[model samples]
Target: MAAVGNRLGDATSPYLLQHADNPVDWQPWDDRALALAREQNKPILLSIGYSACHWCHVMAHESFEDRDIARLMNERFINIKVDREERPDLDRIYQTAHQLLTRRPGGWPLTLVLTPEDQTPVFAGTYFPPRPRGGMPGFADILRQVDEAIREQPGAVAEQNAALRHALGKLSRAPDEGGASALGNGPLRTCRDALAASFDTVHGGFGAAPKFPHPGGIERLLRHYALTLTTDDEPDRDALHMACYSLRRMALGGLYDQVGGGFARYSVDEYWMIPHFEKMLYDNALLLGLYADAWHATGDGLYRRIVRETAAWTMAEMQHSRGGYFASLDADSEGEEGRYYLWTPDEIRGLLDDDEWALVEHRFALDEPANFEGRWHLHVQASFSESAKRLGRPRDQVVALWESARDKLYRAREQRVRPGRDDKVLTAWNGLMIAAMARAGRLLDEPTWVGSAEQALDFVTERLVDSEGRLHASWRGGRAAHQGCLEDYAFLLEGVLECLQSYWSDSRLRFAVGLADTLLARFQDEDSGGFWMTADDHEPLIQRPRPLADDSLPSGNAVALRALQRLGHLLGETRYLEAAERGLQAASGALARMPEAHASLLTALEEHLYPPEIVVIRGNMEATASWRARALKYYTPNRLVFTLPPAARPPGLLAERVAEEGAPVAWVCHGSTCRPPARTLDALDEVLDQSGGSS
Candidate 1:
């Protein structure tokens, strides 16, 4: 019943809508806001954050909501709010500016004061409170000082802005490392060595405290391990160990939501004991693949459990009725961070009988001091056998008791005020989850999970993609908006390819081909090789950002490279292959400088060094299913599999291939060279193994 207070009321982004009632007069990033700032000759206050970001909410409540601070912001600067998820291009550009200005990483809610003329940042910081605190200047004080400096010392401000522009421009340009010919395994070796050096021997993962699940890095490690295999015991075994160790610690620690399923955004502590607790679709998607690979490597029941549970959580919480998965789950619930997940000793006692409570207390380290602000975050510390030995009870009994306790606790937690969900269906993230679901379905033999992936893919293709075959970035409330970025097309292409392998469909294959064409037409950097983050027709920002570095998620260019390589080989399209090669060349310098940092790019580089084996299983669906299953039995990190009827089209790679025997047959090829058809599952296994798991 309350009236919305600002221009954010008309915005599509949920993050922008969250500020609809703020007295700050927030405008969504648009031409009107820029024009107003230019006309008024005032600095622009650009704040970028996502809907589910906790600090974003804190800043909104502390500074933007206060009328006094709002007045200061309104009079001096034209204020704009951006949902980082909605406009990753803008976020990437400004975050880079913030780093350039402050010599540190930028995070939400990113605050910047930019010139109205060119929108180059003059000042940048993150999360300034209403009152001076955390060694940061108060929002009002900072605003006043910035305004005074701009007015009193216009020449100095202009000089600083000019310097920033020059610096940013230099940073934006890709480095000239060598030529495209420099592409090889040299960078991959450098990266592997760096990871080995930084790897935490005592704990899992690399680096020090505040460990994040770098799924891309783990994936790279897995591939490196596969590539460098020399019997069971070797020095190269370290790669597999590092990846497995990190995943093990994470699964056992608070990062993995024990009561529910899925992973939090990251751990706040080194041991993965305390998490930030926001669940993101991208994180789970990446981790799912890693875990599935881990299971394939070790045949560990724990890894399998993780893969199943994470997929289950995604399906239950993230998937929308329309089929596309939601963006994220907020870290906060009921005005408190981790409130939905944390528990008290008394609360546990109330839910369980004395024996059950006691067992759980010891098993989850609840009897130890409270880990999260005087409340317990349930994290499994002891194995059932260990707890049973200590308690003088049978292991099975302990397991039964713990399961019962967990169910009751999960049920009770469900009744509490749940964290807010950002229901916007992101095309890139859905692509990620779709890939995860499809892979898990095939690898773990879960048809329902594969079906779930197909359904989500159907939703994205129908809703997010326009009739002209162009893809949109997001969808919500039966409407799609925002032109698709490089990631949207690239990631979805990967997903569509995965679905094709899971259950071959003619329409999805056509969709994949269309997406590949669009990626070339819209996002490709014609002169310089890698793809741009935005489309050629996209609204221009301060810079045309072409980010090649890997972050929490893989780089867009890296993903684009992999997608192109796979699709090219699958379809026998030389254009896609050439584009992929160009992409690798473009990223060559950056990869050479910091191969460890460019895990995904290193992966694409590996593919160039040793092209993936392409296996086309052509026959009746019923007969070919066994052959397809056998092809995936071994862990082939750099391999592409497609199971289609004898008559599937595009007439590219599958042109001459057909069913030979009464049973299904597989045509195995390395690059353009084809091998004789393998008629039996045993014959296919021998072919794959002879190539040392992958070509």
Candidate 2:
């Protein structure tokens, strides 16, 4: 094929574009590259990674850009660069092979080798430095030995390739129908312990160095904590208390953008003090939902205000032309790290009068020698109560003054040149945003946010999910491309479900359930227990990882299983529940063996084993304005509540129990059965007390 240099320059993928000038001739995943490898009898050197991956950037700059390395790659291998985001299928397949061949785990900047005739990888690894470093092999050494082995022992190479391929084949097998596959809730205790041990008691996340904010993991903990505490029959965290502790801690940490009011992708340290600097839309969306819940649980207006400000920033900055949210804002701008976000002490002082500046500085702990290496990265000084106590004023007055200060500083910061925004509108990420906004509106009682969510949802339904109910994965500059994977389906379903609950819109729930069915039919890996990350019809990836567990975001299968369980409960269908159960069975083995490794997957299992309470209110969602309003009054992340018009019947799942009787009513269903309808606000409250999913 055309070497790595020629091939990569022609592709438009941002990740691929990031490598366009690499010395290595990096061809995109196109026919010419593969064909040339076969014709020349050279091994295919496949490299896979994404733009936001810091390590990926490092490897690209080190080996891929080195002329000597490029010469070796040119002389010895057929190189191809693939963007993991645009081609997750390819990344999945090879990542699986990388794990099997190396007898180790796989991650980005995946480097692999395969027979020159075709691209079946025989050897694989993550990053390889030019020189041996950190107990790792040098790229040149790996290249020389691997190439020599292939040339000198062709038969042996073929044998190893066969062995790896066979191993991968089994790793991707469907779940057991015989129910022999072993996994369950009993051992979930180990998973919980693992999480507890790793939890940064000081910070609000798991692990130490290179810590990522496991938003999903934290939520799962909150769900459990909320349940256990309220029941009081057992001793553990119930969902509400957990929802409170974890969210409050995170919001107070440096992981949050204390000044601009959004969350960074993660904190580099366990203390949540140092960040890698990129602010992602999905992270913000998920955090927004968390903050909204925090407000509901504690009636903390501060939490509600943070949610409101975050929503404002999201719409003001991240919203795409079609109403979809953009993926991320890069960590760097003007070749300076966090330049757009960080401010000098003098800059802060310049914006306010001497007294105001002193007050602001004292409140935020800002000093002459900046907290973040001479450039201040905004963060909170103390709890509002503590600050109020210190200020000798009422809490509300203190809060009001803090807001005034933040507003003044925000206006000043807005004038600076902003960071580069990756304007790619990914469906899954956008879906998270839409759902977050909608849920915030419902949970914290914000009508303005409800309007924002409606507009964004309208845009997604119109632009991404076409008339035929098919979903597209990404939209950029008016062009939507690629077939959507499971994440797109799962996250969008989340958005629709949130909208349905917020407004009691039958059209929204009806469509959400309809699309859920479509997802079941299209993305479900029937052979396995749950869903595939990518749809079955998409082109094969380099590696096909059968979603083993969750990561930064919730797994598609996890969300899907939850969706099925909720939809089935609302519609009162055993089929949906049955599908969910089957999915649990399929996922049981790994989840039990190492549930901590897959916290999100464990969450799905939790859902199937113990589904949430589904509260369906019929009549004008406006009629039960009091009851529907009551549902919105408290924060209940684990509860699924939706409103349907009296004239509009819910699916068989929810319709069987709730009255379509042309009057205002609220029906609470749990453990797959419904409590009688509630005709008044007090009646609804009583029903909630008796049968509601509230922990």
Q: What is the TM-score of each predicted model, taking all chains together? A: 0.96, 0.88
Error of 1 at 313 (Å): 1.0
Model 2 earns a TM-score of 0.88
Writing each residue's lDDT as its tens digit, candidate 1 over 494-517 gives 898889888888778788888899
Q: What is the per-residue lDDT of model 2 for residues 583-642, given as tens digits with 9 covering 90 to 100? A: 777877767667777766666666665667777777755576676766655545567777
TM value for model 1: 0.96
Can you tell me which runs of candidate 1 are displaced by over 4 Å? 1-5, 177-181, 230-235, 392-397, 660-662
Compared with the true structure, all predictions reach lDDT values of 0.86, 0.73
Best by lDDT: 1
Error of 2 at 2 (Å): 6.7
Model 2 clash tally, residue pairs: 32
